[model samples]
Target: MPIILLLQLSNQTGLLSLGDLLLQAATVLHEGVVQVVGSSSAFAAIKSDGSGIIWGDAAKGGDSSRVEHRLQEGVVQVVGSSSAFAAIKSDGSVFSLVSTACGGDISCFEHQLQEGVVQVVSNYLAFAAVKSDGSVITWGDAAKGGDSSRVEHRLQEGVVQVVGSSSAFAAIKSDGSIIIWGDAAHGGDISRVEHRLQEGVVQVVGSSSAFAAIKSDGSVITWGAPANGGDISRVEHRLRE
Candidate 1:
């Protein structure tokens, strides 16, 4: 495809919209398979007929034979983590696309993910879903932000956005408060900066192993591994501006 070749050019100009990419991808699927994607682990593809295909580490979402019926049509988008693949449909439903090793099997979460899921996000090994009611659902490796038991209460409702570090997740609520979970070593823990994140948080930026939240007041609070911008003490005075 000229588009693919052109994207490799040193001076490539203009950005491709999602619609453009999808159209181009559809064309490339004429032969059954061409567009391939990888996450921290796992692979997925959309065939010529708009059906989806999966192959990789079987335990990590490489196989999708179990739920092939639901994937025959209407798989609008697919995303994966190190644990499994998540296939999204046009009607706001998410399919757990893999085995049990890495959360590929979501039979346990089926009821919760049956409908009304608006968005889904992933880190290196975990997945989080944001539903229409403002609630959140999670699964995958426990150490990589898959578990949110600690802050489950806060995530019951009002969540507007969610972002992830390598092994942690940070969510911004409707009230502008921040709720985080996952591996504490990788930015999940917010105890040290919890008070400051109570309200007015406009956005949350996540690095490979840290997080920085910008409040509506223009102040910033950071956490996680100090070496990865989690500790901005040296520039703390400058941030006051």
Candidate 2:
């Protein structure tokens, strides 16, 4: 299959034959590029057939050579971190690639990622996944959110949503409570506002270093790095019921 590869040369211009570039890249052209995703240095495209083709910087997940066999088919979605990419298959399994130090290497959680993944989210250096059972799994640089040990128990059940910042994560539970972890200086440590997070946290949002939670009673709570957004003291009166 020949794809419509547009090219421009100094003296001539036309299609650039992918004779040796990609075997199925052309076949899926008619199916069209349904979706495209990129990391710091690479990009991946999801075709109509649910297969993925990747290209760009190998270190940023642009190279899918390592997971070529898996991307040949059944890929539904691909999400990228700063240097890695994670693909979710039709069967609900997840595959990762790119800089191992950033998130490319996920072998440690292979067993847990075999199946049941429903959604995945990431920041610049880590990845978090929500399982069908409402549980969350995280992997990547520990300081950036790879480790969830401190709040693992709190995340085991009834988790409705998980949001990420540049260096941390915040999760909202079914009971409307909030759990946070990751880089303490970057919004992971919410001890300063723990009392405010105990209940009624309807939604939690974050920036690169802080998080803001909205409660059912019409109040707001913030924590993490104060300079980035943690401190709402200037507007405290406005946040009251």
Q: Which stretches of candidate 2 lie over 4 Å from their true place?
A: 1-31
CA shift at 156, candidate 2, in angstroms? 1.4
Root-mean-square deviation of Cα positions for candidate 2 versus the true structure, in angstroms: 5.7
Per-residue lDDT tens digits for candidate 2, residues 42-154, read 77788887778776666667666667789877999999888788999999999997689898788989899999998888987999988989899999998889999888988
TM-scores of the candidates in the order shown: 0.80, 0.86
Tens digit of lDDT per residue, candidate 1, span 1-241? 1112111112256876646654654554557653566654456776556577654455566556767787777777777776577877778888887656665656667789878988888887888999999999998787787788888999999999999998999999999999989888999889999999999999999999999999887888999999998999999987764
The global C-alpha lDDT for each of the candidates, from Candidate 1 onward, is 0.78, 0.83
Q: Count the backbone clashes (under 3 Å) in each candidate.
A: 2, 0
